[model samples]
Target: MDTLTTTKPLATYVVRHADDNLVLGQRLSEYISWAPELEEDLAIANLALDHIGVAHHLYDYAAEVEDDGRDADGFAFLRDERQFTNVQLVERPNTDFAHIMARQFFVDAYQVPLWDALARSADERLAGIAAKAAKEARYHLRHSRMWVLRLGDGTEESHRRMQAAIDELWRFTGELFEADDLTDELAAAGIGVDPATLEAPWRRTVLATLAEATLDEPHETVMRTGGRRGLHTEALGHLLAEMQFLQRAYPGLEW
Candidate 1:
């Protein structure tokens, strides 16, 4: 039960989720000054901070599990694209406000339940991190759900755009629930939540929200994946270039 001395599997399991938050945090940060309203800009900024905060905690825990001298910053800034294990969904470009909301909604919907489940993880440290993260994810869900409803049920043009955004991102949702070997092993040990078990409730929660928003769910076809194994879209490379620039350029520079 002493996770710090655990093998790489535990560290990998924890950091994979950290990668999701770190990647999405960086994505949301890109919208910093550009959101439509002043209050909304501040909201997005706060959300970005929340995500990055969670990422740091998870990364900190992962580093401890690895029993390496590497810290959170090393995980955040030193890893190359292929080394990242975040899902592809969070890495998609924020094309527009509707797109942003759609992406946020899908991710928030998933994370709220994910954190809730993780809060009870057999790993006490991860459970503590999840307990804190669950609070932020609920707030994030409210923010995204509000915008999704407002846009999807408002003007005809807004409805079209929101629907388009939903369609564009739907394929990525499947990957969020797919359970693989790492998850299987961890779940059996009670050290992690099996995402496969989370999918049904996630569907109910998401579909209910979409119905309330008067939006049609996109039919599923292919599910985009591979981020767990370090395969990502081109966007991640560009994102890493910008996000890692300071650390990469400065090497060991301190503030």
Candidate 2:
């Protein structure tokens, strides 16, 4: 017997991360056909696929803990947006290339530490999943960081766009490090990593990357909150509606 503690509490943790990626992946997929050019459209589509792939992988792990026969597809397609636990950061629309990179960079930085830590989770299954996913997160961060560096140091226009995106998106980031009741529950069960511990390494990685990119880290501000407790931006409900539309309208529907 594995004799490992349950990953049920860890489901709360995994769902938050996976749901965020799933929602964001859906948003990016929306932009695929509308990109300025075929090449750009293809690039957008590729990124969308990558995000969705990760989302599905995480969801599968979450479903494993459900023990109610709900698989990844069931969990993903069946839930309403309001019921989703993804952060507000992932729900934001992809405004531009810079905007997309900015969002990805912020999440990817935190994800690296998170998944790396989860690789050793007391829950055996989660630890295995984390070990595999951490590598994917690493590649994701690398891709986003390279784009950030290029855009920040490229032409004047690119720099302006990148900087604007950074400022606009930075406010939502505070939620990533915010610990709450659910976090407390999971942490108590040895299934979750402490958000506070993630902050230092996250800061180090982010600052070092921004400095190398020749971009000035914006001044620390008051910071924004919500998302973990389901208090999300206005955009999330609409997104959930679309994402869950088919599932809601046609229960038990499958491809």
Tell me, by TM-score, which candidate is best. 1
CA shift at 131, candidate 2, in angstroms? 1.2
Clashes of each: 0, 0
Cα lDDT computed for each candidate against the true fold: 0.90, 0.79
lDDT of 2: 0.79
Clashing pairs in 1: none
Please estimate how well model 1 matches the true structure, expressed as its whole-model Cα lDDT: 0.90
Off by over 4 Å in 1: 1-7
Output the TM-score of candidate 1. Answer: 0.96
User: Which run of 10 residues does model 1 get worst, by summed lDDT?
Assistant: 1-10
